[model samples]
Target chain A: MTTTTTTATAPPTRPVVSRPQERPFGLIRHSLALGRRSLIKTLRTPEQLLDVTLQPIIFTLVYVYLLGGAVSGSTQDYVQFLLPAILVQTVLFGGMATGVNLNTDIGKGVFDRFRSLPIGRSAPLIGSVLGDLIRYVVATVSLLTTGFVLGFRVQTGFLSALLACVLTIVFAFCLSWIFVLVGMLVREPGGVQGIAFLVLFPLTFGTSMITPKETLPGWLQTWVEVNPVSHAMEASRALMVGGSAGTHIAWSLGFSVLVLAVFAPLAVRAYRRRT
Target chain B: MTFAFEAEGLVKRFGKTTALDGIDLAGRQGSVLGVLGPNGAGKTTAVRILATLLRPDAGRATVGGLDVVRQAGKVRRLIGLTGQYASVDEDLTGTENLVLIGQLLDLRRTDARARAKELLNDFGLAEAADRPAKTYSGGMRRRLDLAASLVGRPDVIYLDEPTTGLDPVKRDDVWTIIRSLVGDGVTVLLTTQYLEEADALADDISVIDHGKVIANGSPAELKRVVGGQTVLARPADPARLDDAAAVLAAVAGRPADSPTRGVVAVPVSGDAAFTEIVRRLADAGIAVTELSLRLPSLDEVFFTLTGRHTTEEAA
Candidate 1:
């Protein structure tokens, strides 16, 4: 067969171009991006959502059914007492997510990347702490909805209930700063968990989550009264149960701010060292 | 040419261990400086300091005339860094990873997305742009990591073993990207354990050992330090190998070593020695099959300066 060969010529394609734009550097923008990325991860990881939602519901149900009659006089009374405690317990435990997620990111070399970036120094710490607020809100709403479904009523008005919810979330949000510091100080995820538990267990269990501090032994009563978490739980419970707000609320708000003020800087300092 | 980066007596210590021992390095604008060393040789430490991720305990470093320690924010604005491994958020898609960096760099949302798209296309990651980085292959993840660093169009890029785990082909792809980066007037400080990588990509190389720079020069200049032309001779017949060896030995006046099954190697002083050896071998009717003179490879230079073979010392 006779054939003729011809070279194929094609028209030139447009050159690939990138139009660069100037970027501004500020704390707010950096923190917002850091927070946005973290929230996006939470959206992708449903398991993270499940932990905050499922754990509180199950823990509240089990505690009310098993320990209600023994701990309090009646199931309804126990429900009233248990709901606020569950709020504090669930949200405080949920704060562990901050440390766990921070440890995971650091272990995976994510923080190393953050270190190389030209972003605000406190962005990651603030972002992760703020990100855990989403988890806290989820747990709070789940517990409150479950309590309402279980025939537990909030004697406080709607505004008070909303305010109580805000206080609980804010308390948990501040608590996360401590765990964020723990996460930065410890290199391993398990170490973060251990340290978080060591600090949280005493602050939580030594308080009056189920029984009133008045019912405890003299020394134990004093310990519970002095426990910052107990004051937070008591203030939240009193506010939700139609009791008059007192020094407990002031102390809780003051203590939450104090913890945040102390730990936020510590966490930021540790994060700087870590990166 | 202006120095894109100049570090004078950069010293860094972690606890009592000195990670960098007064390292002095400079890279010209639009050129590549490859820091070659084994593991624990302080290559990464130097890159970290230059990238503004770590502060030097002594001396000073500057990128684009911004001090790495005192003016770290300005230095950071002028540089991008891709570390030994991919450090993007795996939970996010490749596009999201780049976009997040763009946003962190303070790009508006629209600008960030546009920059992300541009980088994804430039890095050959457009097809997997929507896929989470965890799903990407090692090479793709590395490319995405590089793309994320370029979101700000940094003037100086620090690549710390950018091809550490990549296969040869993938490594070549990265090398191509690095070449294009330098072609775009971007300075690169590359750290690598692969000597051939330095020989291929570096405008100048510094070989560090035990936290100190033991040698620094262009690849050709460094290779010349371990002087002598390598003479390779192959005999026409396997049985005549000894004759060829004797010829090489007699002409060179040094012991000839057999590198292969039938090839003898001798160090020649110059081209005259090479011609003389070839003449001697031809006169003996040895029918020399192969004769060539080669300058020492970077491996030989590394061995001569460090007193250890690259491969052996690397292990």
Candidate 2:
């Protein structure tokens, strides 16, 4: 590729596909093709949809009805306060399936089939992430619809609400790399679930999703301020409910980039090592 | 001339266990090389190395003259692998599985679909092409697995114990498919524990045991190395077994073996020995109900080569 000689430029005599370098955007092409497979798998198995669809609706219902009064002083105020953060939490939870499904597939023939092909080693991992991106979108729409039904109104314009949805998905997509790394290293599918829950509970719960930052004690308040999940949720709430979201949005995007930078390489490397 | 695929001094170990210990295997262009061995004897390990699934600790392997390690990507482009367990995506229908492979190979979407349809029809999976592979029978699943590999139309293929668990009829179906692949000038490296499978398909047989090549030759050559053609005679009178044995032994210049009740069989190096035995048996006034001459079975050759029966080790 550095110095293309005449022989290199000449077409191959064999009808077989040329070298990997010769195929432009081979990574993206293969990854999207695999992503379509994951999407079809999702469509075929309706039960896997329950997490993105029902979990958000059920969580919104129970949270607004049961804990809404005690936390926000009224169910009405709580729906507005809780729904946006619920969108953040639900999408993050839905993202967990990427790792779980990947871990399950590693022991199956499907993973080997992907690895044996002459494609990018990271295609399967990226394809799974891309395929699971829909879950976050589903959670966002489902939670937002439930919120609107429960008397939550968007103070911001349509553009801002849409921005919130996109931001929530981006943050979730970034955070899923951590689970993908775990999935690559862990041997058993069930072990992936156990570790995912262990990491996710603290990451998602430590956020400012349930209550305002002011209500927490000194140490917890400071931790929430630094937590990226808290920033993502904060940015989501502001964009949807109307507030100064400039700082939160910057923090969320910055943290998302940082997490993706650190973990995406690590996950793909772990995949190569594990396989 | 270079072989279609070859492995020289391949050595691989897992912790304390040596899975493949300097095994040499090769397949000529447009022919089959059968790596025959019992379970844990490293047939699969050797195959994995040649398929670029595993790297040999010390050895050189090439497919169509491209080094497996240094040019693994290029190797993948030229080869296909079908594991013992059919590796088709069970969730997808047969058509989708093949189409997925086609797309991975960078075929146009319409071309991929057309290829899938053709392979499905060719493999007699047309009716089940729309059904998820998980629902297909075992034989159908194997056919789809094979079809998936052929999507790229590779010149060399590695079938690692491709018929390990299949029934008799299903195994024959696979053998026919392999024959057709070879008919198209594709080279095949087949591994199997079934002696008959190798005998039926391989042009060359490499008998492996405990990660080493203990014996290597054509089927007829390996049988000759172990011994030679055997002449058998069943006495018309069960009481005359000893007389028949003595007559055959004298003519062949070796002691005859009574492998079964009332049947005396002796190893003979040539057809002359068989005719001599017939003349001698008649001279001794021995009437035989059955008489035949044949090469030694691969089962016996395997036993002679390894000094242990496959059934014993397999069990």
Best TM-score goes to which candidate? Answer: 2
* Model 2: per-residue Cα lDDT over A58-116, one tens digit each: 98888888988899899999988888887888998998899999988877866766777
TM-score of 1: 0.86
DockQ of each: 0.30, 0.28
TM-score of chain B of each: 0.80, 0.82
lDDT of 2 by residue, B252-303 (tens): 7767777679898877778898888888888888899899987655455555
TM-score of chain B of 2: 0.82
Positional deviation of B71 in candidate 1, in angstroms?
0.6
DockQ for candidate 1, C-alpha atoms: 0.30
Clashes of each: 0, 0
Which ranges in model 1 have alpha carbons more than 4 Å from their true place?
Answer: A1-25, B227-299, B310-315
Supply candidate 2's per-residue lDDT for A119: 84
Cα deviation of B313, candidate 2, in Å: 4.7
Q: Tell me each candidate's TM-score.
A: 0.86, 0.87
* Candidate 2 backbone collisions, by pair: none
